[model samples]
Target: MTYFRSMLPMTSEEMVFEAVRKCLDDAGLDAGDVDAVVCGSAPDAFDGYHHKGLVAVEPSGAFAKPFSRVFVGGGTGVGVTISGWWHIASGLFDKVLVVAWEKMSHPYPHAQPLFRSIFEPILEQPLGPNLIWIFALEMRRYMERHRLDKELIARVAVKNKANAMDHPYAQLGAKITVDDVLKSPVLVWPVHRLDISPTSDGAVALLFASEHEAKKITDTPVWVDGVGACLDSQYWTNRDLSYPYYVYLAAQQAYKMAGITNPLKEIDVFEPYDPFTYKELHHLDALLGKPGLAPQLLKEGQLERDGDHPTSPSGGLLGVGNPIAAAGLMKVAELYWQLSGRAGKRQVPNAYVGVAQAWGDLMQVGQVVVCRA
Candidate 1:
């Protein structure tokens, strides 16, 4: 995976090739060994090009191979890995290459403005609602519902950025305190500059192999125990912003497939998408099927790298950088590294089972993957 950064010198195709090449090398294989390829990118608007997926075909090493791309806004990252999982599961391919890349820096002025197009033209667009504004509303709802202090919520950024200190790919890793977060410039009410992840340019690639081929590749292959994805109503106004019901539904599906009856006890590590600070706690609750539990976990320091249930040990989008599709996949990559005992300094001890989730699309889409080693 390419390092998450505000800007990379390479083009989108080069980034794709670089990640795919590294993935192949790590697996002791070559592009010819991959029977199929699946690519994920958030939007053509971010790349400033049409058919962004097709443009990545050659660089993704999909020439004359079964190839396709998947997009679900920010969910595209983990969504692509799920797509690759099925390609091998369906008995169609033994080896599959999954590539997720985003170049949010290409959008003029800022990538945040590109989000305006995601809203409905007739109703939502008139109000000029972007992701931050909508998320600010969601954050306020969560805070008010649970009566959570802004300082308590700020700990998410503090913990994640500090955790990123050991991450080589992290973009915003720092040793920040909650006081530092509360003092940062406020972009929207309750949403400080430190609360949001920086827009970035990066790519992440993963190789999926069938049980038969996986044994040949590595003795410590991380298995995809289950995968789930769900999309709620497009009209974001109709849903309860205080909690994410969609994420719970998606997590239930994945846990059930993995025979996980008790997630809080069975899952050793978590990598929930954290484009915003509160989202880490929010999604953690959904993943655990216990609303209001995440904030408490944070307060208790159970979400830290050395805590009982380590979360976002890769720094997450908050500190590592938000490269859309790549950030989500990076979570899955973190799981693979952690479970395989290869996470280096950020490694979670005895991390046998891990869950990674990503949300997007009008704040209603949820994508989840469960991995075991």
Candidate 2:
């Protein structure tokens, strides 16, 4: 694994092209076989580029293909994935290439200011708030409401970074204990620097084929069982930050589509967004339909890679790295790998139904996809 910050002068164009090329090669297809391309990217502010879709063409090798872009902040990756599914599921194309990328390091000073800018200028911006403040507020809210101790939350940080130890592409795997996380400097009250994932420059791509084509391509194709995305009203003030209401709504839609009545029993694994330590628990509580469930699950070791309710077996954004849109795709890709039994060391036992999710945009949006193998 490499330091994410020390990487990526390669530009997203090259990243997109290479990732798509790898996807095609793995699928045993050529560029000519791709009927269309769907791209997902973060704000042009992160990569410092305008017209991201058009700019990505040359390197994406979609020159003569129908090229399109879907921008959904951090949810861009899975967002484009659902879009590509539409292309094929709509019977408009047999194969659609889905790609997502982010170069957060391109922003001067850091992506932190860019994250702050996501706040409404009139109401929130004038307060001179940094992103950590909101996270702290959310963390404090979740903690105060549940009387959750810091050590219990620190376990997520320890577990996820340990899980990343097995991911070949991971950036922040360590053997730290809960005490270590507790000892790390606090960036904000109840929000330690160790609790946060590093902003990175990365890209990921996948090929979505029509069911008919997928059947012919591989005997062990991972089926897209369901997908759901939702957004909440702006401002954390509008809703309770402890529970991700939008995340629950999106997961419910996905579970219904997948015919899952009991998520804990029906779903084999979880890959929720984890840009922060508390977020993993925050999103899971909503996803599980029980508030304060995540802390118990984490303490019971149910979230370990080989545990009963495995979560973030790919190290999640915290361990593997967070490149905005690319991070979401990584979660989706991790599901594919776990389902197909291609995940090397991080693979779970007899994994079948799993969910991948990403949450961002005013801290209100949630994107989810269910996969079965």
Candidate 3:
């Protein structure tokens, strides 16, 4: 028997419901067949609402069912999916439904100000820093140490947006260039408006079934061969900004579970969190346990869709729009599509296994999933 998985976009509760309906339709199953539901999202401040899990229950078909909600900032979506997979793999449930959503547009002062709360209020806030500041600082450090130019960073934006052109749920799609990114209004030093993912309102749903149920439903079931999640101390000031220690730890755990001794050679594709261009490179280094290769890959155009190891083939958060929790789930969805041979034109050639990772909340949390066709 094998395990099966599916994913759909999250626009609203209604849209989420419709996507779940489609997933059930595609799987030839119904809401009654599900054993449990796991929902995830970021803080209420970003959504301008509280108890979002309750609001999602009825629409997501979790009503009257065993349901749970988990939050870990941007890692919430992957955290929920990992939870759902565990429920089925633990001999408790045969099927699980995972839902992740974010409505950043609902907030009054925009989501930017709300993210400031994630930092240490006494120290970081007094310094007049926001989320972009951290990313900008990370970008600056990466460029200075690695000798990368702004043009290379802009290429990430261009490639991701171009990839988004084929994504049905993509929010920003354009034939952009490096010049477009450099010329875009600067939000923070070294971080331009185009470098950031927009505040979006969306959700994504995924269905996972146990080996017994999966084999009965489809001949080719994408296996959840590996999953790893870890958190570092919330004290951001104590950590090194040059590299993400949490991401490395999480990758080490997931790679071991997947029996992958060499990630660069064994893994077919990658979907690292690209909330910022530097993040893609940051995660790649952590995932591979070597930061030195990233610059070479970028210089040789190996990180593009047509490259040796395609990263962010779904355009990632940068191109697809960042709906927080939903963005991570979207990367998982891309892995599912690629593994199932349904990615259409965006498909990576002969991709047998893919790794999707999400880093969240001051680079303190890391979630990694390894899926196989």
What's the TM-score of each model vs. the native? 0.99, 0.97, 0.95
In model 3, the number of clashes is 1
Worst 10 residues of 1 by lDDT: 123-132
Residue 73's lDDT in candidate 3: 82
Better of 1 and 2 by TM-score: 1
RMSD of each candidate relative to the true structure: 0.8, 1.6, 3.8
- Which prediction has more favorable TM-score, 1 or 3? 1
Name the TM-score of candidate 3. Answer: 0.95
Q: Give the whole-model CA lDDT for all candidates, comma-separated.
A: 0.93, 0.85, 0.81
> Candidates sorted by TM-score, descending order?
1, 2, 3
lDDT of 2: 0.85
List runs of model 2 lying over 4 Å from the truth.
1-6
- Against the true structure, candidate 3 has what lDDT? 0.81
Clashes of each: 0, 0, 1
